[model samples]
Target: MAITTDKMEGTVKKELHVFYVLDTSGSMSGAPIGALNDAMRSTVEELRKKDGEKADLRIAVLEYNSANRWVTQGNNGVENLQDFFWTDLQATGLTYLGGALKELNTSLSRNEKMKAETGNKVPVVIFMSDGYPNDDWQEGLQVLAENKWYRAAIKIAFALGDQADTEVLAKVVGVTKQGQIVPNYEAVIKTNDLQAFSNMIQVVSVSASLAASSSQMLGTEVGAETIVREAAGEGANTDENGVVIVDATSAGGDIYASDATADDLDGFDVI
Candidate 1:
């Protein structure tokens, strides 16, 4: 008698999509926007070369000023987000974050960029702003919170200057509602310094892209919690001064840790 055992086949490579929601309002002009351009250019180059080894990486960018526009195009209102390329952005107009959020929700489906059956990793969304919304952003946020993909995506935000509303940014990046916490991965970085601003742009973009690739290689899904851990290692969780960045927490409360004690809590015992 002869017996044969079946051999498992290799998994098909899945798509990893990264969406960038950028505020190109007039306030972002001068050094802030300049740094953003440079950092984004570097990020594009880094991801192009680094992520191809493990996964098929794709990117889509939505910029909002007085209105929102897609920097990259797709066919028939659907973006075929594979082998992504980046286009440098300029700053102008008002912060219409709501419009951008609405567009993001529309684009994240099987009819658009997502393929739920393919084992595609959850998408990552990075939002950056230097001011508050000039439109009905709350409505948009409400709609976005209901989107399955938006809920699952790795969300991060940067409050680039002091004028940037940490409260609003907090709500957008890490929380779905006033008191609810985002599922796993969400972070908000705040800094008024341009150098630190640019550094974080590079750090977060590259780290997120690499995490997507690593997950593909390991045959594991990219976990938002995991992204947070890896990003901390790459110094994305702090300012140039080494202060750990504070993210939004449970809506209406302290925007940051009450004291520096939490910063030193790593060495303390909790039992």
Candidate 2:
């Protein structure tokens, strides 16, 4: 008889935490909320199949409306992807996005939520919103900026519809090491179609997980920037239904690219 062991034992797996900062304001009620709930359930199912030797995938969800709340904080503030469950969210009240940002800042700290003794990768944060914030979002963002974990995390944002504040979403996702807002590097994806919105959530979640779980050599570009570039690249323009996936020109110029010239991005609009 042959015996095979799954592991030698005493091995600590590297952890890759993914946070979904969702908006559940009154504006997201009706069809929007239904689509969001369905999308989140499917997204979680997809993530379950992504755990690998490089990193053990974990997930956290924070939803905001009149207040912010965590859906997966029962077990050390994060749960393994395979064990996580998606509960359908109800939408109502004001869009207090600023308070959500501050809440996330607290969770991202080493002492509070992320207290792993070994092998901790930079977290991936996905923010989604459909309307303007009703609170002091700028101050909340400013507070989050001071956290080393937030500064290093891979950040992406989604403008759900025409009513969404893309410029504010851009600022939320695109903060340079020097504390500058380079809109191009922000990865603010916009889609008005509900199906397209669902597709984008899956695409970005998978792409970012693949990137963040891999090992990067020294001086490599940020994972979020690479995700945006590939998403906006030529020939990858639309989803299966032919809805435009990303508008690179409007997204901003390449970040940390030395060969990029002013003429190459002449007509691009930043915002």
Q: Which candidate has the top score in lDDT? A: 2
Evaluate residue 179 in candidate 2 and report its C-alpha lDDT on the 0 to 100 scale. 56
Residue range 115-150, candidate 2, lDDT tens digits: 766657878899999999999999998888777788
lDDT of all predictions, in order shown?
A: 0.67, 0.77
Clash totals, every prediction? 0, 1
Q: Candidate 1: misplaced stretches above 4 Å? A: 1-11, 74-85, 115-119, 175-186, 212-271
Error of 1 at 231 (Å): 3.4
Model 2 TM-score, 2 decimals: 0.80
Q: How many residue-pair clashes does candidate 2 contain?
A: 1
| Candidate 2 clashes between residue pairs 3 or more apart in a chain or in different chains | 184-252
The ten-residue window of minimal lDDT in model 1 covers 248-257
lDDT of 2 at 157: 87
Alpha carbon deviation, residue 78, candidate 1 (Å) = 8.1
Candidate with best TM-score:
2
